[model samples]
Target: MHLENLITQKVKEAVEAIYDISLQSVELQPTRKEFEGDITVVVFPMLKLLKGNPAAIGNAVGEYLEREVKEVVAFNTIKGFLNLVISDTYYLNFFNGIRTDQSYGYVSGGQNEAIMVEYSSPNTNKPLHLGHIRNNLLGYSVAEILKAAGKKVYKTQIINDRGIHICKSMLAWKRFGKGETPESSGLKGDKLVGNYYVAFDRAYKDEMLELKSRGMSEEEAAREAPILKEAQELLRRWEAADPQVVALWNMMNGWVYDGFETTYKNLGVDFDRLYYESNTYLLGKDVVAEGLEKGIFYKKEDGSVWIDLTDEGLDEKIVLRSDGTAVYMTQDIGTAIQRVKDYPDITGMVYTVGNEQDYHFKVLFLILKKLGYSWAENLYHLSYGMVDLPSGKMKSREGTVVDADDLMEEMSETAGSIAAELGKLEGYTEAEKKELYHMIGMGALKYYILKVDPKKRILFNPEESVDFQGNTGPFIQYTYARIQSILRKADFDFNTNVLAEEIEGLQDKEKQLLKDLEAFPQLIQAAAAQYSPALIANYTYDLVKDFNSFYQQVPILAEPDTRLRNFRTQLSKKVGEVIASAVGLLGIQVPERM
Candidate 1:
């Protein structure tokens, strides 16, 4: 495991024998390109110790390293760089461990450290959209990766179930003639509530314009202000066990939760904890008051509370409005405090939200730190970028927002159509075709979104994303199918002795394939350490590309030489397992057939 570290360890040990400085500072880096060799170490840092020219120092160290370090089978000096190549024998060791071990190229790294990732904190006022899909997938994928790396991950989602927004729906429902519910109307509860929300907006705007013409302020004529006040009273009534308000509140929230559950089930996002905004928004109000008493916050004349963050290079954020109402900030601060009080020893809290809230997290984190919570430093804002379409930005108000359910349905249909067009499945039953469509379509969707760097905005192109070629998830899955085909046909019994001994019997394709294999453990650790799934995505694609190239250049079961043929087939089997494992981490299932 960690091939790069092992090679660096050997080189550092060899250097300690040649010179007497702390080898801890001796940094070893991998070669950037293929021609420079597998790993390269700069000798320029060690030049002063050698007391000679850069080239002379490089040559002396390179010669000493290759002779002294068994890990370095051959090394050479070019200028001040010591280029070290691990012998092909090392690849055999790496490949053998990966092939034979049950959990190869993986470690329980965080050692039971606990972290919480909160994602898809959508409002119940509307349906889950494409933005929520991206948030959910990233959160779910990151949770899996962290768990694989040995962290105890707590996946939580805060349902935004209250506010003026929720009130709008209630107002629309009350003002409209019919006393209809989602069940009776045959409309999704969230969508029904959302329709009411739109209705409220349209009516409120028309009323406000007329009021403005009659000499009242534009804001005064907006009955939404009164409706929103009424909704808040309704929320209080529900909280205080008022039967009528609770009944309607429960009914509306039920539909939204049902819709959300289906999306999560299809997208493969699970939560260990669920927080409701209505419950927690008021929880932090007192905490802000506590801060005020401690001189952490100042109360304005109008009774609003503010945290001046100018000293921290941030604008002051309002924790409570003049009327003593909590905003998103106040609620988050409360939730964070309550979570820490509940879990006490949580090692970290990772918030998986859009990058738009970078400033919000920056302020929230600093405020937490100022409040003397030692673990405040562990709060990480995993800021992911926006998901734009090939056409343009998606606007919710403009009805350009793509619903999560709609997108999933479209992908499934696309997969079915592609399956039909390719004619890959001859005489397949409808049930079988549906299953293939599910895997391919879902796999294509997840891969297309996650393949890019999380912080980089993605332009999703339906045409390019679903293509069965290039660096997409389907491409890797397609490669898996090919390998499965070979394995089914070859049925080769792998011999460990031959695999260990005949490392050079491998073709140039075989050697490159081995190098690709060695990158797995390093790749796994790197991806987890950086919290970047794209690293794993890129590595999986590279391995498949190398394997595909090897497959075309060298035949497995078709070879005349029994030993060589068995070796290649066994090698293919090893690659197959790794691919399956990596793709599984990405929340993409590799169908046995597709």
Candidate 2:
């Protein structure tokens, strides 16, 4: 059992034995630095039941716990707070128990229910941008954290492959290109397609300008743009399954898919299942019809289907058009149902979308609940804020967005420059240097984005993220590498457990590290529960800070005593391992050497 659980039990027993009254629960927190204790118990809550002065009650409980519990060696009372000093033996025992655990902080085989996490559902018309990067990193890290916390997870994405936006790229490519392909153009397929999307926008704007100059209103010019009409017509033909249109759609979408796979590989994110808008666009019509029959949805005189949710604090939303066409909401509803059907074991789903679509997800989840699905209550919207750069906001159609591939390359270049300046790659060959640069670059990118809460927007600065000091990924990676260096230098075996008697007394630094290590498993559970990788990222940072302080203050390789040296080395190794584990959950990699 955990130390908290043991202490809580003892505290309840102490209260019942002393006051002859059963305490409902105990409130425990980390002991303040000035307070000389491992954990502090608040006696104020028990005051309501015990009927006495807070300090007196605290002292009584503290004395009783010190007398009754083996782990509690001493105690101090500061008003309502009862701080108990835990024995070094208890921490040593706990350390020995977890030292050999390869996955020390992770819970194994606990929750049986599976969760599906959906993210990076990019449109096929363009290459992924910085926004998509955040979506992928957040979803992937959250899924990994959930898995570490013992819940089975399936990562998924719904690719928006068929829409007017896709048609715009296809139409522009066909109209402007004189038989250009990704092969002949020497460009990635997604980038090639993305260029045409921008071209289409440019052409559409020019046409609208011409129409407006020819005496049409702004709205009329926008509605009458020739390129817009062409794209809409292409969409209609594709929907009708016209052979030419279908062939073009297939060819273009296939190129985009191939490009996306390469990007996903580079980004280190993968999906267990892939959903396409093409197949699912018409899926919810039948469900909407059924809902209308059941009075869960209503049909207007013009034949549009709607669901009134005004009483639920939301406006009425349309599910199907008068022409019997499904809207985005209807398609999402059907896609969700289809996912559950596809994965029957899925007990919950997390939709990793931007905050812009917060209202959409709320409506979708609520509609599913009204439809009487048991799993609807388990749906989650992992809505995150937009990612901006120092240069300002990105616009895809204007060809101004920060392309993900370009950003990654820039990060690698920045890391390489920083490494060169630091002169840490003296023995590394060219190829090894390149690989290290990429790892550090990607690590910095992922960590920087993930360290912030998902609901907060980011103004990312690439140079700042790669700095080798102060809460950055490279700093933590450097500390990990330093630990590896220490382990390599220690000739004697430090893997064996250090017996409690062999180590004499624990230093303040070592005890602090042990306490931080003890918090790891609980931290994992908390991060998983909150669905926040920021918790994991910041916790790792704090742990690294603790380890660094210990390293500076305590001598491991230079210690004269064999037992003390071995124990310190073992503690360092465990800290390194925990750091690796924590950062891994954030989708950041650690280097064995800096």
Which candidate wins on TM-score? 2
Q: Candidate 2: where are CA atoms >4 Å away? A: 47-50
lDDT tens digits, residues 1-594, model 1?
A: 365666566656656765654465566675655455677788777665556777776666678767766767777777877787777677666666666766776676655688888988999877888888888888888887877777777889888887667766776788882888777888766677777777777766666677678888756776435555666786677668788776777777887788778778888778998999878978788889899999999988998999999987788889999988788898888899898787765878889889999999999999998888888888888788999877788876544577787888888888778767877787778898888787888888888888889999988875566678898877888899989888878655655445557645446678777877776776776776677788888889988998999998898888877777777887888888889888888899887776
Worst 10-residue lDDT window for candidate 1 reads 497-506
Question: Could you give candidate 2's per-residue lDDT for residues 126-189 as a string of tens digits?
Answer: 9999999999999999999999999999999999999899999999999997778899999889
TM-scores for every candidate against the unseen true structure? 0.92, 0.98
Candidate No. with top lDDT? 2
Model 1 misplaced regions, further than 4 Å? 13-19, 32-36, 43-54, 109-111, 177-179, 209-242, 301-303, 495-499
List the pairs of residues colliding in candidate 1: none
Candidate 2, backbone clash total: 0
Score each candidate by Cα lDDT.
Answer: 0.78, 0.93
Query: Model 2, residue 369: what's the lDDT?
Result: 96
